[model samples]
Target: MTRNRLWYCGITLAVIAVGLASRRFPAMLPAAAGKYPGDVLWTMMVFFGLAVIWPRLGVMRLTVAALAISYAVEFSQLYQAPWINALRTHPLGHLVLGSTFNWPDLAAYTIGAVLAMLLELALRRFAA
Candidate 1:
């Protein structure tokens, strides 16, 4: 893989780790820093994941793809078939495909996607 893709992969991994940690050790964080941060980080991870897959893509396109995916996944929670629920019971599955749908999650996802896009733009400018 190219160096930029490798960097994106590393960033995605880091975001995943931090997101998981936020959920795993919620008590360690401040009371104000609740579940929303984790969701936001998860969306950010999605953005970085797309960046890894298509590093040449522009920030706007990456943001759009990531937000679309994050929104779709959140919406998918509305369909609670036995099979999908069973899969959601697994830890990894639960992390990727959340159990319930919350309206605020859409806001969190939008915030995360925008933050990710700005970060990428800043990084590109810095690198240039």
Candidate 2:
């Protein structure tokens, strides 16, 4: 992989780890910290995952695509077919395809996409 792609991959992995940790150790966090960070980090991971797939893409495009995808996944929770609900019962599925819909998650996704875009721009400036 190219250096940029490698960086994105590493970032994606790091975000995944932290997001999982946020869920795994929620007791260590304040009550207000409930699941919001994980959702934001999840969308951030999606942004970085897209960057890893298309490292040469513009940050704006990646941000749009990531937000589109994250929003779509969140909206998809409205569908509750047996197969999908069964899939959601699994740990990995629960992580990827959340079981329910929440308005706040859309905001979290937007924040994450913007944060990812800013991070990418900052990294590019730093590297240059």
Candidate 3:
């Protein structure tokens, strides 16, 4: 495979591995949370944009979709909608958004997606 494809898989796999490993090990994420919201948001955009530009990767689209899915799940918690809310209480939900919904989370997702799209356009120009 090409270098960009390999980098894409490596970064994606490392992200997953670290995420899972940190769950079992339980100490890595809080430090990340320490980052300024602006920095975190920018990093999200950069990584997501790179995902689109990298050979055989589509990080930007996936990043936006993932944020949307996360937002939907978080919003669903407002309903106490039986299965949905119950599912929200589990570890996966905590990993995604925490136990409650906030209007700010929607704003974050929108901002993240918009930033990702803009970054993708910029990257495409450079790539071309």
Winning candidate number (lDDT): 1
What overall lDDT goes with each candidate model? Answer: 0.91, 0.90, 0.54
Query: In model 1, which residue pairs have backbone atoms overlapping below 3 Å?
Result: none
Regions of candidate 1 where Cα sits further than 4 Å from its true position: 1-3
Candidate 1 worst ten-residue window by lDDT: 1-10
Q: TM-score of predicted model 1?
A: 0.94
If scored against the real structure, what TM-score would every candidate get? 0.94, 0.94, 0.48
Give the C-alpha miss distance for residue 17 in model 3, angstroms: 9.9
- List model 2 lDDT by residue over 9-95, tens digit each: 999999999999999999877989678888889889999999888877877888999999999999999999999999999999999
Cα-based lDDT at residue 118, candidate 2: 91
Better of 2 and 3 by lDDT: 2
